[model samples]
Target: MLETTETATDPKRARILDGALKMFLAYGFSRTTMDDIARAAEVSRPALYLLFKNKTDIYRALASVVFEESIAKARAELAGDAPLGERLFQVIDTALISVMAKIAESPHGAEILDMKGSLAGDVVEGWRAAMVGQFTAAIGEEARATGVDLAARDLSPVMLADVLFDGLEGMKMRVSGAEEQRKAVRGLVKMVELAIRP
Candidate 1:
């Protein structure tokens, strides 16, 4: 569950976060200010302060929404009754490829998405751990169902999840475009399916 500093559903709060996202993407996080967010949001500066402590607070809130939605969508995909490889592909598409593609289309998007030196690093880390845990559980269940002897293979579900997560992150960093990413994820998913085949 997302522990956002502010509730995301409130219209005013949503407006603030959405407006902040636009400002941050347009100007980069370092250059975006509370005034800019307030102006963009159509809220008074004092009203913005009432909702968020400052620029970092808005950034963190915005990040929480993004990460929460990404994980939620990925989890929903995994919960479907698709084959293991298809499910994994859905997870990757929702969590990384689709999200990254949207961000890539925005101005200064990468700068805003950069978690380093940001107050929301913990938020990003939490999301990562959650994804790893989800993948580990899913992979363990699949292995059991398929009668794959992970012990004989010298692999554990967590280790498998770690490798998969690393590869997914690498793709996010190295893949240049949406179509390329889709192809890369397909190849990775195929490899995972082969590795786990009964």
Candidate 2:
């Protein structure tokens, strides 16, 4: 039996994806066309179609990659042997700061902001859920360490996590400048620290 190799093996496909991402980031889902992506990538329209089904598909692919990358970074940041409080703060601070930096550097920062309500909505929400769940689990672990019975708690981990995640997202959307973004995120980091304190 012959093994199937990856079709994306061609450098041309990678170029198309890279170019498409830039175009999508520049023009957004509603404005970008396959032709624009092909032109930017220096590939034929037919070639672009072969690589991606449509603009939505390309955006989904890019969003998935971005989401997974952010999640991995947050998880790695939380993997330290530091105290639970410090680990949680590191994860929130590092991940939010990285996300803000990416948005600030993008040419279509406003377009990127609108992506949360598009088809990529699921990707964004899914990532948020995973991040919050991780934080909640960490909190529960800390509670156990402190001899507190989480079972008798009035506040569930999910509730607490949702509040923190929503607050972080709100803060991220409100900041316009890089300095403001940094300040807003630091404030959020401090809020999370206060909230998680025993």
TM-score of each: 0.90, 0.78
Measured over all alpha carbons after superposition, the RMSD of each candidate to the real structure, in angstroms, is: 2.6, 4.9
Q: List runs of model 1 lying over 4 Å from the truth.
A: 1-9
Clashes of each: 0, 0
Superposition TM-score, candidate 2 onto the true structure: 0.78
Cα error, candidate 1, residue 90 (Å): 1.1
For candidate 1, the lDDT comes to 0.81
lDDT (Cα, tens digit) per residue for candidate 1, span 1-198: 233335545778988887887787788888888899999999999999998998888887777787778788778888889998899888888777777677777888777667533678899889889888888888888989999988787888888888888887798778888888888888877876766778
lDDT of model 1 at position 158: 87
Q: Give the 10-residue window scoring lowest on summed lDDT in candidate 2.
A: 1-10
**Highest TM-score among the candidates is held by which one?**
1
Extract clashing residue pairs from model 1: none
Error of 1 at 191 (Å): 2.4
